[model samples]
Target: MTAGVQATVNDASGDPLGAHVALVIVVVMVFWAFLVAGLMFEPYRQFGHTGRLLQLTGICHLLTVLQDSRSWSLARVGDVASILMLGLLAHLILTLPQGRIISGRRRAAVAGMYAGVVAATAVSLRYGPGFDAGCDCFPPGPELSAAAQRGLLYGSAAFFWAYGLILGGVLIWRLLIRPHPAQRRSFSLAALTGALTIVGVGGRLGLFVMPGTPAPDGPYAVVYAATLTTMVLGPLGLVTVVVRARMHQASILDATVGDQGLLPPSELENALATVLKDPTVRLTGHPPVEPGRSGVPLRIAGDHVVHLTYSSALDGQPELIRSAAALARLTLRDDHLRAELADNLEAVRASRARIVQAGDAERRRIERDLHDGAQQRLVSLAARLGLALLQLSRGQHATATATVTAAVGELQDALEELRELTRGLHSPVLENAGLAQALASLAERSPIPASVMATGERLAPAVERAAYFVAAEAVTNAIKHSQAQRITITAEIRNARLVLTIQDDGIGGARATGSGLSGLADRVAALDGRLTVTSPPGRGTALVAELPSPPHDLR
Candidate 1:
């Protein structure tokens, strides 16, 4: 009985220090599971599938711990469960960051891993010993024939070594090579954890398979320590990655708030790309319709104004995308307003310059008209008068009388030319009698059969002058350019504005930019008015000028 007790004690305490360490590790893992599970809850609730995978991975680790138990039934159950969960671990690793499997190839690979693990577990259950006789902690196996037992041991061992190597190789290949720069650190850590797990577990399995290997105590303990370290670090690493990602999202949102300046389209896109860590990010006026492309609509005041397109890497975090889009909408709106204000200011500057230039040209034209017309006529009249006085002094009565009569005719011609020039400058009739009578005078002077219909209401001097000039310019254009038979001018106060309309039953091709019409438009615009010309081919021409005409007291 004493000898039996000694044997039992030796079996139970093969590696006391290692057992104590493993116990501490198990306790740490338990605490870690609760802590990490709490952290993963939100991700799971929001993105259900990813959280589920993480839960399954945690379960697999728990079963892995159970596989180290001294109870035979518990060890056997844990071994089978852990083997079945290998595929889940692979699936979780491959589909990290993104919760769902995106590609068919990866899905098929995970499915194949599951099938292989099932087949391997079935073969072991059917043909292999349930427990290792050399280890007191291992579970008992089914009674099997010697040849069948050997086949199970060698085949399962070989398959598992290949499986571990393949899984480690695939994890490293998928995550380490050309991984997204933003996710590189997480991928690297996950890859390192997976590689360490495979090495530690595979090395321990290799020790058991070697010929003439003694009971696994010294080297087994070292392998076990490495395995426990990896298990502890794996979940911790994942937690770190998740926490870091959350912080990253927060930082991005904070950065957007800091960018309060008016950002141009290109600059806005660049800033968003920088914040999202996606160079493929773009801001577009319309939503993207291409395959593999996703867009977030940015709405302002319940109206969708623009779209934000980004890489699919950001698809996992819809909250982040929405927040970014809201901020982008504000930036884009401000940018548009700033651009419009700049354009308006530039247009005003250009309009003022054109007005000044037109004024200078008009002055030069008036000077030329006086020099070539009234001035010449006046000079001729003076010469004729001087000649008439000379004739009178020489006692030539008949010639002097004829010279004075010619001088009187020349003086009349000069006065008429001066009146015409002054009329062009600012019509006295418009100032004295308002727009209605001024339009009547314009129509009467027009060569075509013309009629005037106007309300006799007085208007602001500037408005009346603008309306009169619009009518005069329209009449002149119609007479000079339009082959019209009849012209109509109408002026009235409508909706607090002086509405002047001129229609001609003539050739319908008057351009608003024509020399006479352009000047008229400028005159109307100076008083905050608008001039519209409609002259479609084969249709009669019409000119409508609208000038603001408030009540006299308001003006």
Candidate 2:
């Protein structure tokens, strides 16, 4: 560290006449080196462009040292280099934060400045001396006529002045009007740097337009001081801009990382806006879909309206946003994914609890049905048969026969009730006849006119069972509550999963958390399948179930 300081001190005093310019160049070079090093190790490149501009801004000042030297060739080269540097500075200020040109107007401005610089260089090469009289760098060249020299030099001057004024005006306008605090700060700094650099450099270049005039020697110290001051201040302002931008981004990430999965949508939006320094950030969600969707939701960030396209980074991963606008997008996407996972976990817990509760309730219902319906009938049948035997012993044959007939009828009713209870517990038909036949039978039995469209060879037993139960429950719910005229059931194998959909043309107000649908969801969940219910009142109810095929079934 001591050695580094000593090196810096030596560099600053290397040329006493141009000491300040040398120091400014060193400071900017050091800033650039650190920026590049950080960019190499850091994952984010939010200030990559700004770093490059600072480096270029510093390198341009090297020509200042060259302008002071006695070598005519070096001085001529320095003049042309300075012209190029002016254009570069304009380009840098106009395209801040992000390095690339943003709008057509800014693009045209940069293009015009570049064209002006090129024209100026071409004319200077044609008219100016290639070398001094005693120098052996190049053969002496014929000078252009005074008229031609003035025209070329004056035209070039006009170009530089125009670029400086236009760029400075734009920055000033932004500083005055832009509502965002960060943007206003950027514009303000840029305007100050631009004003200083333009006035200082443009003034120096203006003197060269007159034909056969030598640049001032010593009395113009004020001009040299102004030029050095602007060069020094420009990089300092840039350093501040880079630091502030990085801090803003880091603060946003810190706030977000703390709340991770807990922020409600509104708070999340606010957090994002605060971090991005854009008060107008918005987020939107796309529901899970089959065959997927083509587009992502629309969100506005600062001055840019972005359509976050959906793409997956890897197989079996959730779809992620494709955005290049800001560093905040990375954190924002991560927070969203974390929140979604949290919600799904909560839903799974609730589903499990409901499943346990529903299972207990179902067991009690079965017990009650047996005790009230079949058990009572069986007891009555036993009593009547006993009476029949007693009457037969008393020789009343006709009465005994009538009692026996009544007993038999009671026995048959008891058998039917037990069979129904058994069917409810586990369908024998579904076990024996497979999915298609069972669903067909279900459609046949429904009170509402129903149709079944199932097409698959055979799925895993668990998958088939889950699919069948989903269809059965949905149909029963539609028949009982929907007051519908028609029901449609569709089952197909898609992407190695059994997909089933049940729709009813009735009053549509079914909720996934409702008792009946909730139970069906548990059944589907057990098989690692998902069930979604869409019921719009007065429109229709649609229930969809997707069950993954077991490994053997896939084979």
Top model number, lDDT: 1
For 462-502, candidate 1 gives per-residue lDDT tens digits of: 77777776787688788888899999888888888888899
List the RMSD of every prediction in angstroms. Answer: 11.6, 10.0
lDDT of 2: 0.64
Q: What is the TM-score of each candidate against the true structure?
A: 0.51, 0.57
lDDT of 2 by residue, 1-555 (tens): 222233334434454435544544544554454344334323335433545654555566555446545787777666566666767777775664455586898799778877876676555445543212233334567766778767876775575556556666655554435424545564467557756666656554544443454333332334544554565555555555455555655565565555444344446566655654545445544522434323344443343333332222111111111222233355455555677789989988988999899989988999899899999999999999999999999999999999999999999999999987776557777778778888898899888999989874677777877888788878888988999999999998888788899999999977878888888888888778888999999999999999988557843
User: Candidate 1: lDDT over CA atoms?
Assistant: 0.70
Worst-scoring 10-residue span by lDDT in model 2: 313-322
For candidate 2, give the lDDT of residue 319. Answer: 12
Regions of candidate 1 where Cα sits further than 4 Å from its true position: 1-49, 63-81, 96-99, 126-144, 180-183, 198-216, 243-336, 345-506, 512-555
Please, what is the whole-model Cα lDDT of each candidate in the order they appear? Answer: 0.70, 0.64
